[model samples]
Target: MTDEHPHRPRLAPLPEDGWDPSARELLAPIPRDADGRLPHVFTTLVRHPGLFRHFLPFGTHLLRHGRLAGRTRELLILRTARNTRAAYEWGRHVPLARAAGVTDEEIRRVGAGPDAPGWTPADALLLRAADELHREARLSAATWSALAADHDEAQLIEITMLVGQYHMVAFFLNSAGTPLEPGFTTEALPAATGTADDDA
Candidate 1:
């Protein structure tokens, strides 16, 4: 990341020494490398401390308090990452998606898209919802009804918010040129099969 993207980030991340007491307390739980530094996105976002403070609770809710199944949330997040061409987001979520029970093959196929063979009807619809929202900014009636069958009112609301949240996250990650930290999020984000629609 250093050499390949030395100047890619338009905004420099706050160096560790510059972290204040509040910043340190806030970032205490974030993963650190052998060098024990915070994640690139966190350090970078902290450059805008006010925005970071306000965004934390909302992001935390989607990540920790959402009603969707872990695997479901991960799927939406990964799909949203692909849709936005946010490689940083995609790389970060690959392991999380896997840990949440999404298989390696399934992860690969997500890039292939919701229509790719082998997805169960439910899984396909979930990914399709991501695609429809990404491309159209809203879900189709068919997709919505299909999702409604398995998800309750709260889960349904969670579904849209979770996917939309990642879209917002992706926008910042890409625009800010957030670098993937070493020993973390090193997965290669592959381009999906078709670029007439890509983001695999």
Candidate 2:
């Protein structure tokens, strides 16, 4: 899909030499590209060093310590990215989603949403929960019950927070107009089929 709003970034990425000491410290744990440059998202976010410092720990927890399975978390993030039309987030996570074992077909189907054919029950429930959260800010009774059946309370809570976290990340990426990293492509997945206007 063509970008509807290709606005230039309101906060441009900081040059490497321009990074604050605090920002550099916060970014230390993130892996660098072969060129030793940080990802565009990090570079852009570090323009606000205080926010970047506080945001990284929680994000690291979600990525490294969340109770949700890797594939499940990736699915939640990918769906959230699509729901929010966050091209930068979507592009960055595509390979991570794949490494977590989301198939190419399943990735494409994510754009079609929970009702799309061929999803296992658990996968469908995940997508439905993501859709409901994105559109309505709450899960339907049935979706909540379905999720509760398979996940422990901790996992269930993590799932909800995981989606919310990615939504916040997407909002920031889209609002700040963060560009995709070098060689990144947002076209790997299909265009999102569900709109914000669609009923959850």
Candidate 3:
């Protein structure tokens, strides 16, 4: 996938300077207070703690426990990751995608835009929804019909929220220099494949 983020020179080691160690501390497994423990980005967002609390539960619902089918949610997330080229979001979700039964072929195809032929009908609709969401900020009637035909009301809402949430996450990760997870690797896609930009 493309890495669209602005480049930054690596900063020197932390903990040497007197800067708070809270950032690295949160990445540890042990839990801490809400303000003390979160993803690195969340910890940085502590400046706006109220927004953190607000998005946390809503983001969790769309991502962790919402009504959307696991694989469908992953497909949407994968599309968002590529659209934004958020390396860190892609790193975190690709494993979740695999666990949700997304194969390497499916993962590579995320960059393939809406018409890639190997996807199931549901998967194609999900991709179309992603495309529409990116280009128009909402799904078109035909795309929504494709989704609503198979998904219930709750699932439809969940999918909308999931798309919005992941868009936010991808923006943050890409803009804030959220590093790709340690030892994370993405599968390579075939060259000259159809892409979201081309479809757009």
Q: For residues 106-153, write the lDDT of model 2, one tens digit per residue.
A: 988888888778999999889888888888888889988989998999
Please count the clashing residue pairs in each candidate, in the order shown.
2, 0, 0
TM-score of each: 0.89, 0.92, 0.78
What is candidate 1's lDDT per residue for 1-200, written digit by digit as tens?
Answer: 11132337877677889889878777776777577777787888877778888888888888888888899999898888777777878887898899999999998888778878999999988888898888777888998899999999999888888888898888788778787876655677755453214522
Error of 1 at 107 (Å): 0.8
In Å, residue 106's CA in model 1 sits off its true spot by 0.7
Instruction: Evaluate model 2: give its lDDT.
Output: 0.83
* Best-matching candidate per lDDT: 2
Which candidate's TM-score is highest?
Answer: 2
Global CA lDDT computed for model 3 = 0.69
Which 10 successive residues of model 2 have the least lDDT summed? 191-200
What ranking emerges by TM-score with the best candidate at the front?
Answer: 2, 1, 3
For 1-200, candidate 3 gives per-residue lDDT tens digits of 46455565132212213334443333343244344433445544433445755666677667668888799999998887777666667776788899999998888888886798788877888888887887779888998888788888988887787888888877766666755434454543234345456677
RMSD of each: 3.6, 2.0, 4.9
Model 3 residue 28 CA deviation in Å: 9.3
